[model samples]
Target: MLQLQVPCSWYFWALAFGFNLAMHNLKNILISVVIVSNLGKIIRTCTCLYKQDSTEHHDHIE
Candidate 1:
């Protein structure tokens, strides 16, 4: 009985450990994706603003 129980407990612990590791990795991936998408949005917004400013400036000069 002792021998059978030890192996079963070990298997359970291993499964738990793997699950925790996977969740941690998934969280990191989600965070990175959000950060990257936000950065892209910010870059696009800046580019649009810059283009608008340049066009307005040229109009004033003309």
Candidate 2:
């Protein structure tokens, strides 16, 4: 019984370890995606504001 149990326990531990590693990697990927999307949004907004400002400046000169 003891001999049988040891191998089973080891298999269970290995499965759990693999699962934990996969979840950790998935979390990091999700975080990076969110950060990149937010950065893109911020850049777009800044570009729009800059364009508007330049247009207004040109209007004033005219």
Candidate 3:
């Protein structure tokens, strides 16, 4: 009774849906990490440069 109950297209559809969902989730996660990491690096570098410039400016005035 169970052998004939399942349809052939049902498995294909289920697999395709699951694959699509997995790919979408993976893509979103990759993009988020890349953006966050790059932004953090940029902010840190800017802060370092600002501090160095201010220190140099104060030394030149003395």
Candidate 4:
């Protein structure tokens, strides 16, 4: 009975540790994903604005 108890407690502790690690990693992944998406949106908007500005300038020169 004592031997069985030791392994059972070890397993429980291992499971808890793994769960905590998974949650931490999940949070980091979500944060990175949000940052990347926002960056992509900003870049796309900037490119569109630059294109419009250049085209307008070209028309004015002509």
Q: Indicate the TM-score of model 2.
A: 0.60
Q: lDDT score, residue 11, model 2?
A: 95
Displacement of residue 16 (Cα, Å) in model 1 is 12
List runs of model 2 lying over 4 Å from the truth.
1-22
Cα displacement (Å) at residue 46, model 1:
0.6
Candidate 2 lDDT over residue span 1-62, tens digit each = 99999999999999999888878799888999999999999999999999999999999999
Per-residue lDDT for 36 in model 4?
100
Write down the worst ten-residue block by lDDT for model 2: 20-29
Candidate 3 displacement at residue 7 in angstroms = 28
Per-candidate TM vs. native? 0.60, 0.60, 0.57, 0.60
Better of 3 and 4 by TM-score: 4
lDDT of all predictions: 0.96, 0.95, 0.89, 0.96
lDDT of 3 by residue, 1-62 (tens): 56555765678788999898878799888999999999999999999999999999999998
Per-prediction tally of clashes: 0, 0, 0, 0
TM-score, cand. 1: 0.60
